[model samples]
Target: MGRHSLPDAYAAQDSGDAPPRRRRTVAIATMLVLAVAAGTAAAAQSGLLTFSEPCDDSAVRLTMAASPDIAPAARAVADQARENEVKSDGHCLYVEVVARDSYKVADSLARGDKDPDYEVWLPDSDLWLDRAKGNGDGVPVAPGDSVASSPVALATVPSASRTLGWPGKTYSWAELVATVMRSDEVRLGAADPSRSATGLLALASIGASSDRQGGDSDTRVAEAAKVLAQRMSDGDAHVLETLALDSSGAEAGNPRRNHAVLLSEQAAFAHNADSAGSGKLDLFYPKDGTPLLNYPYALINEPELTTTESRAALRFMTLLRNEDSRRVLAQRGFRTADGTAGTSVIASAGGRKPQPYDASAAAPPSPAALQETLGMWTITVQSARLTTVVDASGSMATLVPGRGQSRMDVTKASLIQALTQFTPNDEIGLWEFATTLDGAKDYRELMPTRRLGDPAKNGGSHREELAAAFAALQPVPNGATGLYDTTLAAYEESLATYVKGKFNALVILTDGSNQDPRSISRSGLIARLEELADPERPVPIIAIAVGPDADREEVAAMAEVTGGGGYQVSDPAEIQAVILQAIMTAGQGGQAAAE
Candidate 1:
């Protein structure tokens, strides 16, 4: 009845309930504790469970690492399949389901740092599938069939939703999020983008939301980044748990209480159910569409799995696709792949409404955007080491007649605006260059590269030092450009002190060609760059040539040698646009990709 009742699933499928332990704020920590305990218990029971007789090696033993939200339903399905004697090549199939965080599973598979030890992974969304494959070329990750799916939504109580003028007024995804972001009246909660799909997808939406034309306009992704940096919790589940635990240190019905969270529709439903079916936790679907958790089933068919184990994993996958499993999954609050409603058997899964199964409902981001956005949230929050070199030649003083400002002034303002894009955890230093400024060296390190919060050589935070140095930057009187010498020094210094994990690079902004007559030739510099550049420790040079007279060709050539890029802007006012583009491409090697 359920299968035929509805037949439309645009995105993916879901499993069972949101784990009870995860209902509290300590969900991530608690899951870790459980994983350690579960792993230990599993190891102790491993020997007898894998083999039939004392010498039996005929059985196929596989570990199934399911996402926490869907693990219980998957486990139930596995148990029933095992009981029904699911077989692969005449061998008994053993599937041991362990609930692991999707982010942990994805990162491990991506880096290959540790053995994931599982034949298959069932993360909440298909986003991880792209991420795992992105880790490396040799990664043998392949997508499989998803059993259940759910889409993310803005979760809030009725009073809070009403207070924000929800029911009477329809809101677009951008409007809803912008309201949450700009208004102090509504307290918003979200999981860390680094570790949660809901959080990652939410940020991606916020990032892409402003790419289009708008009304009552909110700040673009730049503003969204600042808002998210300040508002996000340790993790997604943690934020939800906090709201449930202390209500943000306010009484439950208080007007000033924390109001909303970006969560899955199923999660909001389950939370409402736990609240005695009060429908206190309401789901607000953004009319513009939302990101769905497609339940990507990734099969691990690499050096880790034997031929028999791989076959068994596939067989179990086929078994999970059967009608009975769908029924069981449906009762656990998930729709079947074809968009069937949950059964009445689930008393606490809250109301069942048909979910849209289309791109508009669950817009999957491209692989590049996903990685860049995460990098924006993490590597930048806990980001790279960069050295910014500015050309202070007399030519920089030339006024751009249109904007009624000097090129140097416009460039400085652009640089300062770009500075807001990075967090204090990122390390950056400043340097200025002109002929004969450093006694024939042509460049002087105004600030040493260090974490933005570190006490710099000149005192104050590294950020403070850099800002002050940039502000005090004056065009050297009668100064000539010294591009070649400064670039080589900056490159060598960046290489010598490259931070091991973070993206390490140099940013060069200039308005003219190298003018130091005694500096290294273009030929020699190219040779040295080719000889020293290592793909393993990439230090790209993000170069920008301002004005029509700048050596665009030479700038692009230098950037290419170091696996970076160059941008040329004839107008000084567009320097801000170039700065934003440079920030995105700084250590990204031109295009943003998985690191």
Candidate 2:
């Protein structure tokens, strides 16, 4: 979803900077009018005098969970409201602004098992809202207007900035990242994409820029992710700690310290404001476009909120949009809600005129694109152990409608393309299934799951062996689909061989439903999977139904039992993307469960 706006009726009234005398006169006149109206209504309603009661006895208390980076500004606004006696419907607004990590809050909301203990959530980006409402199963969160904005950029120490030609020369996101990665002197670091919006947005921008440049963009993006993982931090605050302690880049040679980091403009501003001469950072806003961190104000479980609490929360949001509140935020290095920053803010953030920091913000990446990038990042950071089971039924030989290749041929090609996305450390194995493929069994393992970097009996690496195996896949003549039995067998094997700390999964691809009458029924297979599933050691099945004939609902039901999901792809060529997407989704689910 894009940006959200307040309705006309609830929009904040901009009380401009009026002189003290003018404000006093206006307040007096308003009070006189209110007093007359109250006198007229007092005869009918005795509670009209309650508006004059002390705030301590008549206050609407609200707890707000705000992102740590902007918590200070938010807290300041809340404090000002309390000190100034800001009121919502004659009730003093008392907000408790608690600094909280966005990812943690998102996870808690996603679980939906307990109350969030807060009326509102202010995250660094709207992306977290998607995570909170995953699959429409998490606690409901309604997106409101953004309170502040920050652009994602690369920040470096003085020495690194000079070496990279920061002010004098500009580079596209992909080119800049490639330059830093190739350099032996400068080490690039970032907050983990799965946890940091700045990291994820910057990575997405790089991917988009790479795609614009064409040719092997996926490989380039995957390689960049690998490099970034080497120097990754847990979150935005921690990532800043990874930067060099000194401005000269000498301390960065320690290997643990980074010469440059992917960070937000506001973060850079904060860092610069706290640092002295050498500790200051210079920013590089990618020439392509910078992604913005729009801190969206969201209501948590709005329907459950009492009317008073809801009105108070909206009043707080409206106050946050006021001119005075905007000034408070801008003083703390934040941009306005629309991303307009003053010259001083940009300069303090180490941004110059030539850096293109003022360019229109990049179009927000779609949820699917973000999901795929995150999935790619997850696999890149944590190696995967996958057992791929492909259908070799007679129907696989059917020709694809506009393509000359058979269904099997296109699937193999797609699978091979997917292989290139995995690192050498990842473990992958191959299996082909059909009716009685292996003497009384419906599945036969062509290769045991092993690291791609490991050597094979034939002398080359396991990767080469897997590639050959993938190329050799063909439809079994007159064979029928043996989906149910094969899925259970592969899942059992995968779980039994689960490697701790790795993304272990069973990937099954089929073009049709089970046809073997003697095989285990769908319900039996699902029941067995549910019994074998372990929460502590999750092995989610990424089941893909290929073509129109495949039973999507059947596979979805079976997959859901083991905390996995089933997806359908009308074209075999779509398998690679779906596999990564499923892996990302399954990985996130596993993380939530563990939490």
Candidate 3:
């Protein structure tokens, strides 16, 4: 474990910028605490950091949840503020900062099971602060008062750098990722985006890049990007970790090596700091754009906060913005709150020498767009092991007033385009339904669930088979919609064949209501759906209804219970956008857009 593993709360409580001698002592003391945590003798009362109730007689207490990586710098600043004995309106103050995983804290805040006990939450990125608010129903998340910032970049070993180009060559984020994805020489690794901004930003860049392209190129790049993102979903800081790791444990000349880790610039600084003398990992500043990990000092403003505590919190925030505080943070590899590469980062005792820098950091996408991107990433990049059920009824052949193609033709093109938004490894099958289209069966499997390639299964890959089947699909002229029964049957089959480690969902593209007399009633369908519903084992139904004649209400109801979504499109051409939104919205536990 790096020096950051020890809880900053204890070591930094009163150590106000320790001198060289005291710093070593503090380091040893922290090591002892860590050792005790791992020690067999301390098994009964493990070395977990816990808070003792602060006595209320003399002061106001400011508790903070600091991101684990930067917790040390935060602690140092807090310790100095502590020494100052910051007073607000004659009240003395106490500041306490504990290392907490940003995702876990955000998750807890979203669950509403616990109120954030801290007067402030210092996540490494604003993304967590945004996520913690949970669609704005709960407490409004106060914006981050950024105390520090870092840009998401790639960190690679020297050997990989030789192949991918070094500090002199500038590659756009798209060009850079495509190079890594197309080859097996060096595997690109990313932090699980749910836990850290590093991986999230990488995947978002890929999605945005693909979104900019036209036609089949968009689909091809997106599918490939998703595969890369999934392959690189290592836990937080895996990128930095990979820089030092080797299976052979060989240092520089070994064949065994990790290629690249999409990470924050600060992380690269930290890793290079850790390995000062040898094997320095290099940073890659993307040419196109990058998302910054702005370490916002977001105040926890609750109605329950005491007036004195609020004042004290403001005072604490002011202290953090001071030169001394900024200096402490900058020395530890973070950019100053304003985001400049001050000499402090290079001049600090263990800091790595500064590398070539680029200033074209991209502005964050709109809040809705960011959420959609995140939702898209969570669903499509992680991917669904889905079985698509398309309506093959006579109504699907109805031609529109303006659009040139039949509903089925537009629907086929849309489905094909949507497939580009998924990983090639994601298992998918095609099924078409209408009453008695295949003798007594309302639905018939056109392609069995398999991986993308035909050879992935005994006969053919799901991707090739489904694409061919969809292209050849013709609406049965005499067929009646089999909405309810087909959904129930499909849901059951999907549930039974659910693959582990895959986001499971059923994509239903329909044009009309259940007109089959033999089909189950809406009430019966809902009851069966209720029986199958499980948040623990979710298989959402992403239903898209085209044209005004489609039964959207009933289709939406089925989606609602199964933790999916129902969408209505005036044009079959709009099916692409609706399906995209449906899948993205459904991926995030179906947090639908506000109606």
Candidate 4:
């Protein structure tokens, strides 16, 4: 027989071999030893044999940093695991869950300058994982299974719900948002997209849904974003605080209180559970479909983790996925990873049949699309203060390979188009550079940075004056690129006139390398920028190499010194998108640094 099989002659030996009491005791002892031996053998076979007693020694401790909204549920599961003495490879698991903002954690991870305090990270959305692993230079984080999910939706007080005809009447995300914006009585609020995954996802969904409706969708989305920005909160939890205190929505008249807010389904459920009667919020699941906030389980700096710690982290993730743990999550207003919830969970979150709550989730936006949306939102909300410097070297007159327009013409048109994206509150200036264009100087200021809404000396808005200047820009007859000196001049001026509480930057567009032998050297320019760059008043230089002739590596190295980045475009038309993308990247980096 196998080693696990008992001997057949043991029963025969026990048949009156000793006194009854002694036989009983001996038999009991023998059975106990055999059982333990069998257990030990089984454990050894599974590669989990441990010499220490369970929970007495060899405990595997781990720290988990979870998004604030889902931290409580994760902590509950962790608590239960400790109480039950859950084991990983025969070692007790002791997990500590800490609530941290997903954005902050992502920023820290993206920097990757130091070791993280937590071994595990549970962000509210997988979107944050992409942010944390920015450009593949950040700390190595391996994403595991999603633990829970929540759909993004609009939440409203009773009066506002009645106004929007929630539950009984449904609208697409675009329609719902448009209706909310058009209404004078209803005020909308949201978490800042730059800092909230829920906000960014909802915004992206609105943009996508609006595209389906056609007819100037970009303008419509921008207008909606502006409205939401008026009452924007710092983050998800803070956005809830912006809601009207009165369930009747009478406080809608108060500028500080909002009648509606973009929120997660789980957040609505938690709010409703704590509220009574009409005080509870009613949710609207946009007809186009809602984006889900998938709470992804991630292992931070996995390579740096010990073998036991790594196994324990995964084991805890398994525990979180177990049925009991899922039930605990549901009780706290979270849905399953697949976005399904029980009837009670749905009802608590203000969902009902025919509201499209059961509809399939909207496809996740591409990383590029999400980045663009965030870039747009960042510039819009912060009100940029930019000094745009254009290279007027003769090379800018080169004709495009396909389009009939010259490179200079295309660059101008693209810049003008980009200008439309900025709000009236944004400050903009213009400058042009070439060899000896301004007597002793290689660069000349065309316009001083001022609010687009501010009046110009020409008796029109600064916006119009700037537009005219952009249009009139012409390549000097035989000018050489004075990139290094022009860049240093622009950076110094931008730093000197730094506007507090704005997205300040110096935007430089060039078509070639620095050709003015009299100008500063690239190394000198970089050293000067590094010395002048102030964290207290950040003004990154967004340098774009506009054509094949421009040295991308040269520009990139210089730009990096000022906490900004560099980009190259084969076609001048691509400059518009690149500018916004650069701003988004720089803004996020600056924000992270400040934090």
- Top candidate, metric TM-score: 1
The RMSD (Cα, Å) of candidate 2 is 9.2
Residue-wise C-alpha lDDT for candidate 3, range 386-472, written one tens digit per residue: 788999999888887688788998888888876766556777889999998888889998887777744744475667667778888
The per-residue C-alpha lDDT of model 1 at residue 244 equals 36
Model 4 compared with the native: what TM-score? 0.65
Task: For each candidate, give its TM-score against the true structure.
Answer: 0.73, 0.67, 0.63, 0.65
> lDDT of model 4 at residue 2?
15
Candidate 2 residues lying further than 4 Å off, grouped into runs, are: 1-50, 247-250, 386-501, 504-595
Q: How many residue pairs clash in each candidate?
A: 9, 0, 3, 0
TM-score winner, 2 or 4: 2
lDDT score, residue 60, model 1? 71
How large is the C-alpha RMSD of every model relative to the true structure?
10.2, 9.2, 12.2, 12.4
Pick by TM-score: 1 or 4, better one: 1
- lDDT of all predictions: 0.67, 0.84, 0.68, 0.83
- Ranking 3 against 4 by TM-score, winner: 4
Report the lDDT tens digits of candidate 2 across residue range 153-241. 99998888988997988999999999998888789999999999999999989999999999757767877887898889999989988
Top-down TM-score ranking: 1, 2, 4, 3
lDDT per residue for candidate 1 within 1-595, as digits (tens), equals: 0111100121122234332111111001111122235544443222222335531255577889998877888899878756765555456667899999887777777776555578788898777776676537534676665667666677765556656665455556677777777775567777888788988888787666656545312225545655565667776567666353233334664543456777876676557656643345656666666776767566774445655555566566655656677777666666544334443422233222332222245456776888777766653344667899999999999998778888888888777766766777788889999998989689999888888887766567778777777778888889999999899989999888887767777889899998888999887887887887877777888788999879888888888798888889887666656654555555333322235
